[model samples]
Target: MLEVKNLAVNYRGVTAVEDVSFRSLPGQIVGVIGPNGAGKSTMVKAILGLVPSTSGVVKFRDRALKQQLNSVAYVPQRSQIDWDYPITVWNVVLMARTVHTGWFREPSRSSQEIVKDALVRVGMLELRSRQIGELSGGQQQRVFLARALAQQAELLFFDEPFVGVDKKTEAIIFEVFEELKSQGKILLVITHDLGTALTKCDQLLLLNKQIIADGSMKEVMTADNIQRAYGDSIFIFNREVV
Candidate 1:
């Protein structure tokens, strides 16, 4: 449902990404995996139109990126958000409606129902009244996920959603992703964990400032492909080499 062609991003004359291209189909979990500074995040930001692309076209469902604004929901890296904000869980999730609902209009009954359902989906309903600063790291992440859920987006972009959380929390988040997939929503998650990406993602995009590989996990996660994307930092010992 999403297409990216010849995407390139430059920052002050330095190319962060060049000639990146990929497509994501509905009901698929596409994982973008690469090491730090590999331009994975830059590609995502360009797709979301958060950063200006030097050259490229991003299309969602036959429409340009700008026309698909509300169709996509972005869950930014938790580290980029200010945790000290005085907003409550309910307030945070409710803010998503500001895009659909005008800034001054009170949320309608349907919007409130959606907010409640989103909190419940993420298991944050009980903490709705609690301040965002009062929650733990995992809980904070869930709140953001709930906000995205409340947005009712057909496509979701998540950046490093499992960065600092514990293993149990990661499992929970994956379960949520599976549920979203079952509901036929397109999911694009930017992850650093190779093992998790191999196991959880339906398709994988191995990137290093460009599209190194893009296909099913079995096709894209080969030893050679991983080595190429990760560079010398990744060890690939083999008896065959000896």
Candidate 2:
């Protein structure tokens, strides 16, 4: 449902992503795996139009990204967000519906229902009335996810969704991903956890400033691929290929 071709992103002459290309089909979880500074996040930002690309084309369902903005949702790294903002969970989630509801119109009954359902899906329904700053880190992450879910996007992008959460919360987030996939939504998750990427994602993009490998987990998570993505400086202890 999403396609990126010959994509290159630059910041003041330093290339973040170079000639990157990939496609994501519906009902699939695609993991973009890389070490620090591998440009995984840059690639995602380019696709989402958060940053202007130096070159390349991003298409969603055969339409250019400009025309398909509503079809995709992005959950940025929690660290990038200012959780200290004084806003309720309900307000955060309701923002997602603004695109459909328009700037001047208030959220309709149907949109409100979708927002509530999204909060419930993310296990944040009870916290909906609570202030965002009052919640724990995991709860805050769930609020962001709920906002994205409320968008009802056909394609979703998550950047390091499991960074600092407990195992239980991580599992809950993965379960939410499964539910989204079951509903035929495409997911592209940029993650640093190799184990979770291998276990949870159907497809993998092993990158280190370039595309090292892209395919099914069995095909792309080989020892050689891991070595290339991580380089000789790092090691995975007791790693067993599934």
Candidate 3:
């Protein structure tokens, strides 16, 4: 299980995330949704210790999450990546193994196999030798997905993973997410999608610099919660909330 209690972040005296708390169980996919600048990403970064937290306790399996970093895999927003970095797809996924294999040592045969399997799962094995910058947006996303899979972490975090992908890539990404859940891996995804895709999560965390609601799709998608979080911006889900 992942537990976050009173997680808060500040930027130059301005509170970005305040009094945020949530629990995610294994085999679950939890979606975090909020309007822009609502600290959706900040909350995740705080939990991961990427950003300093004003106050919080984050634990995984009763141990500090910071001590269990090896068990976590994070895929940041696509826009944060440098498309011109001149790296091959195979090498990109292979980098995940460096944490285990060390920077100067050759990857073990098992690690190589894991990388190959990850690429195959995302249907990017054929393009393994291609430069990441040369691939289409969807293909580039798949390469990152492969990198995450190669790590084989128990906890996964994704920020805006579907922002620039094709339908095929979206379908494949969801398919892999479900598979990971079945394997008892927990997923925390930061997304803005409010349509059918949002329903795939087992739980939802609605945010606006703080947790507005945390529950099932039905509970978190209520009209009242929508009004509070998104204000006058109309959002329709399954024609139920408008």
Candidate 4:
């Protein structure tokens, strides 16, 4: 299980996320939702050690996660990635194995095999030779998904994965999430698609600089909770949950 206790972040003396805590077990797809500037990404970054936390503890099965980052795979928001980099889809995905491959050493046969299998899984094997900048938005996302698969991490983190992709990409990602969860992989996806997330996420973490709600879809999507996270001005016509 993954445990986050009193996770807080400060940027130049400004509080981004504070007093945030949650628990998630394997085989669960957890969605992190909140308005812009609500510190959703900050919280994820803190746990990943990409950003420093003022005070917090992140653990996986009682072990400190920062000490074992090899078990984690993270895909940041699309805009954070540079698409113009002169790299092929194959090389991009191969980069995921760098932790094991090392800077001066060559990738083992196992790493190569894993990359090929990951590309096949994401339906991007045929585009292996193409440059990343040449692919469509959905294809680009697929490439990153392949990279994450190649890592073979126990924990997966995705931020705004569905923002600009087509419906096909969304469907493919959800299918992959279900497959990973069935294999006991825990996933945390930071998303804004509240409508689709209602049915897709196994659990939701509602945040507004702190955790407003955290639980199954039904438990977290209450009208009061929605107001607390997104403010009362936002319309929430569809609150139904399956």
The TM-score leader among the candidates is: 3
- How many clashing pairs per prediction, in order? 0, 0, 0, 0
Please write out the lDDT profile of model 3 over residues 79-167, one tens digit for every residue: 88899999999999999998888989999999999999999999999999999999998898899999999999999999988987889
- Per-residue lDDT for 1-242 in model 2, tens only? 78889999899999889999988888999999888899999889888889999989988888897788887889998778887898999999999998899868989999999999999888889988999989998888888889889998898999998888888789888998999999999999988786765688888998877799999988887777778878776665344673
Q: What is the lDDT of residue 192 in candidate 3?
A: 76
lDDT of 1: 0.87
Question: Worst 10-residue stretch by lDDT in candidate 3?
Answer: 233-242
Please write out the lDDT profile of model 1 over residues 107-140, one tens digit for every residue: 9999999999989887889999999999998888
> Cα miss at 59, model 1 (Å)?
0.5
Residue-level lDDT tens digits of model 4 in 1-242: 99999999999999999999999999999999999999988999999999999999999979999898988999998888899999999999999999788867898999999999999998999999999999998899999999999999999999888888888888889899899999999999999887775577888999999999999988988888888888876774455542
Q: How accurate locally is residue 25 in candidate 2, as Cα lDDT from 0 to 100?
A: 89
Off by over 4 Å in 2: 237-239
Instruction: Identify the superior model by TM-score, candidate 1 or candidate 2.
Output: 2
Better of 2 and 3 by lDDT: 3
Model 3 per-residue lDDT at 119: 99
lDDT of each: 0.87, 0.87, 0.92, 0.91
> What's the true lDDT of residue 111 in model 4?
96
Segments in model 1 whose C-alpha atoms lie over 4 Å from true places: 236-242
Overall local distance difference test of candidate 4: 0.91
- Lowest lDDT sum, 10 consecutive residues, model 2, at 233-242
